[model samples]
Target: MDEKKPSRMYFIGKKEDLIQAKRTTVTLDGRDILLLYHQRTFYAMDLQCYHAGSTLETGDMEEINSKLCIVCPKHKYKITLAEGEGLYKATNPTEKVPTPRWYSKGIKQRVHKVTEVDEDIFVSVSTCPVWIESDYYQSEKGRAELKKAQESGDAEADVNADEDV
Candidate 1:
């Protein structure tokens, strides 16, 4: 039998802080990240919006479609909380047709795994979504990189893919 090593966890704050702020910012691994509490659940995500790099900590939070969404201050892009995907398609109401679709879909924010231990909040910074872990390695570039890494047995290439919820 083999035991897996645990991911590095950085202490964010006490559970009380999460309860008080509902949303707060914390610095872990020298990166500023946001900790959000919604519906009695805790979530940690990147501070910057993936769409236009707007500071997500200062963006507006809304509950839509039974999910938590954040409106990017820069372009009003609605990003979901859990998966960090866009809650709505990026469509400009002013134009009959929105700008030519780019990048396939709305930008996805990078999120970290959150855990509660002893009434404290800890997050693993190195882990992120699949796309982000590959550094947004999409299309042909992404496929080639993933294949090469896998053939070479580069474990880090699939780091995020192994994280547990």
Candidate 2:
């Protein structure tokens, strides 16, 4: 099977700075994103848990059945790295999980597309939580504004470096 690639990249941080099993939360374009690194793979998801809207940044990272899963701190719901369906089962195994005749899949969380370039972590803007309703970057004006902000941030970093010298 061929692996899927991210459509776009948004810089997160240096690869060396990310620690395994540590959750990082970042808000970009008014959308909250949760980042988790485990076994050299970076998983990106919405900050809100599917179960009860709990912040997944505070969830517990665990390795279950050789798969990386996040246990929601509020209800102990577990979500897997590949697919986010293990939560319901882990939390309530005694109850019969309802499923439609057409589909038997359990509750699943949306996983954002992530990519790493060199040492920098990037996430696809299309998969960003904010763009779910309507893509904020679809308009040329929005793209231009984002570009300007990135350029300004770069210039500011350069100025700071010069001041330190």
Candidate 3:
């Protein structure tokens, strides 16, 4: 098996600080990233929604399909904490099932690994090419880069074509 090298980790802040703040938006390399502390675990992801440019720091966390998800306050889109997978409950129009089935939109959010050492917290951006990129990345050049990535088969296809704190 091939082993991958670890991504560079950026120092966030003290775990105590996150525990007190619950959620925080940090600037990394001039880009805003959101850090969330919930259920005794830490999560780091893009600061804004992948669908629209709304903030995710105010988003509510809920369990969907047995996965911890952050529901966007502006549009109610559910994004998972484990790997930033986007999920939507789908219902059968013909059948009479009351509960809707969940489907994956295939990682629509860019998530990072959070590590805690004693009292300090650090975050490492995912090495994979994620589908969930927004903010300044939505510019013309950014879109062109995205297009190139898609053409190179690095970008995942979308269900509805669509992140997180």
- Per-residue lDDT tens digits for candidate 2, residues 1-165, read 113533556788887786643668876645567888877788887666554344578777887656678886756667776665543332344558853222213435656677888878887633423322112222454345445646777311111122210
lDDT of 3 by residue, 85-121 (tens): 8888777788866667888888777777899888899
- Flag regions of model 2 displaced more than 4 Å: 1-6, 90-107, 125-165
Task: Give candidates' CA RMSD values in order.
Answer: 11.5, 13.9, 7.8
> For residue 141, what is the lDDT in candidate 1?
52
Q: Clashing pairs in model 3?
A: none
Steric clash count of candidate 2? 0
lDDT of each: 0.64, 0.58, 0.73
Count of clashing pairs, candidate 1: 0
Q: What is the TM-score of each candidate against the true structure?
A: 0.62, 0.58, 0.74
Q: How does residue 165 of candidate 1 score in lDDT?
A: 14
How does model 3 fare in lDDT? 0.73
**Top candidate (TM-score):** 3
